[model samples]
Target chain A: MIAKQTNQKAWFMVLPVFLVVAFSAVIPLMTVVNYSVQDTFGNNVFTWVGMDWFKDLIHSERFHAAFLKQLMFSGIILLIEVPLGIMIALAMPKKGWGVPVCLISMALPLLIPWNVVGTIWQIFGRVDIGLLGHSLASLGFDYNYTQDPIAAWITLIIMDVWHWTSLVVLLCYAGLCSIPEAYYQAAKIDGASRWSVFRYIQLPKMQRVLLIAILLRFMDSFMIYTEPFVITGGGPGNSTTFMSIDLVKLAIGQFDLGPAAAMSLVYFLVILLLCWVFYTVMSNIGEESSNGGK
Target chain B: MNFNWMAWTAPTASFFGIIFCLLVIMTIWELKCPGGGPRIGILRFETTRGDRLFVSLLGSAFIHIFWLALFPGLSLYWALVFSCIYALAVFRWV
Candidate 1:
């Protein structure tokens, strides 16, 4: 009903996407689901264990701890990046050569791979070798991620902020750029302060992009793996071990397929549910905007 | 959401077992009407080979490999490097 009219040409447009998702997303998901259900020992002997793994995973403290850590991490990152990105976006020059420079510099961090981001920070936070750690230590701060749980958490959070704030900045910048000159021009004639203009015009305009930025960052951060793993190895203690790390430990570290699969499904569902809530909120704003336009 | 354990297990097992069924159904849909796919990054190139995708990945891999060799017991870095190369290639070729 949603797509009642046939657009045969659009199928061509959609074909490549379907193939890629099928190969990557769908297939892997199936494998994970498969692993979740059945019991296996060594080479391919999979006995039907049913929902045993799921039950164990759901009740486990490890899973709960990881889930809580994930929630906290997402909440903290979104709080930091969204507001910081908005401020940075607002401060950015709108016209002339400054635009390109700001845009390019903002985009540079985003181009770096997630693991490399971890590596960069790993090297970066070394007291003897790296800049930040050395500077902090010079100022008499005890900075050692290898032995300190607090330090590892801080390092991972900083690494994530460094890598992903660019995304929020770019999205907010796009939203800012989309505001017609007339709005600002009229606001100017009415003698609006910078705060008033930003509050009335820029902030509302950015609602959609901000929502997208939040949802994307939430889901990615919730499902984060490589960066923290590379940087701290979920280390010092299990303090920073998020859900994905727990799942990986179950599946690969302990070779416990059943529990891991179960946990992965639950993890997947949590992400999906959060995404739906975020989606509903975003769409409500979009609907309100369009209705106002009408 | 009632966990009979038995009922939950059956559907869960069959859910995985019927994998080829869904794949076939999706393949049919693909045959009839292909729609969204993963986005590919299109880099500008001066040459026809346009092996920039491979080149960029190998360059990244080289950096990690170099780091791994220099730092004893840091070979786990290569796993991330390989995953990156795989993701990029998937965006390119798959």
Candidate 2:
């Protein structure tokens, strides 16, 4: 291999990106940290309260409820979306005109803006004029997201599944496409059953993308705000209020900057920790497989 | 730079300063040592020095948060001690 010359000028190119990130992300994050520890009485007058807000947020029953509901929401979506996405990907046409059709349709939901998705579902699930709600109501199902907690939860879950499952499908399809034809030919030569081929061949190849899908879905679902906010408005007595919605309520509605900032920090940390764990565990599994089950 | 909009308190500024210092130190260490290659430790996963440092920092944050939650009356210095030990363990094993 040829030795490459070092280029000191590379830093100049990176400087622009570094500056942008510092301005956008680091500054806002510093502001949040600033708010987390201090009390304000309007007029930008602030008093240092140390970790009091964090302590209160840690023990707050409201926070606890939102957290549990957030966990449940994330868990439910992951459980549904991953397998559903895999199945859709596997069923997707591998070649010809069907490929573009499948790809375009799968990409459609993801291209929709989040709030538009929320609005789409809001109207779609309304019993008064919407198709789903009207059909369910006509079919004697008693489904009203605006009024019932269970209905609201179902609406939000379905909306999330519809919107995000495409992302998983796309990732899985890419993973599936990367598998060489030789592997499938060898499997066919061995007289492998469909289930065996899927279990031994398709699954192992899709593992990396599945990890990405799960992590993305997990993070997005955990921090869900717009859809539930638009659909249910976290109403029916805060039954559908997840942590982000609750944080927004605290920060904007009540203007409790200290506790809200504390909650935001904790929320950010929790997501970071969970994503780290998922990445570690999934990568470890990938390594074990690559090491021939050792 | 006029930074009044941030409402930066002394402690928060110091906290950010410490984080910035840590990042600088890490960068300097990387430049000096060159390769902080991945090593498998008690966590049974390959992690470089940078990864271990991240884990330790995140773990320390959790320790302080938990300490505040479980023992609100106690001084945070104990949590600091625990976090140091945790960081040491991560560096040594994870």
Quantify all predictions' global Cα lDDT against the true fold: 0.77, 0.93
Q: After TM-score superposition, what is the CA distance of residue A263 in candidate 1 from its true location, in Å? A: 1.1
Per-residue lDDT for A229 in model 1?
Answer: 93
Each prediction's TM-score against the native?
0.74, 0.96
Off by over 4 Å in 1: A1-9, B1-10, B13-94
Q: Give the least accurate 10-residue stretch of model 1 chain A, judged by summed lDDT.
A: A50-59
Chain B TM for prediction 1: 0.28
lDDT, candidate 1, at B35? 49
- Give each prediction's DockQ, rounded to 2 decimals: 0.03, 0.86
lDDT (Cα, tens digit) per residue for candidate 2, span A1-294: 999998899899999999999999989989999999999978888899988999898889999999999999999999999999999999999999999999999999999999999999999999999999999999999999889999999999999999999999999999999999998999999999999999988999999999999999998999989888988889788999999999999999999998999999999999999999999899888778868844
What TM-score would candidate 1 get against the native? 0.74
Q: Model 1, residue A170: displacement in angstroms?
A: 1.1
Residue A131 CA displacement from its true place in model 1, Å: 1.6
Q: For model 1, which pairs clash?
A: A14-B35, A17-B36, A17-B37, A18-B36
Real contacts recovered, all predictions:
0.04, 0.86
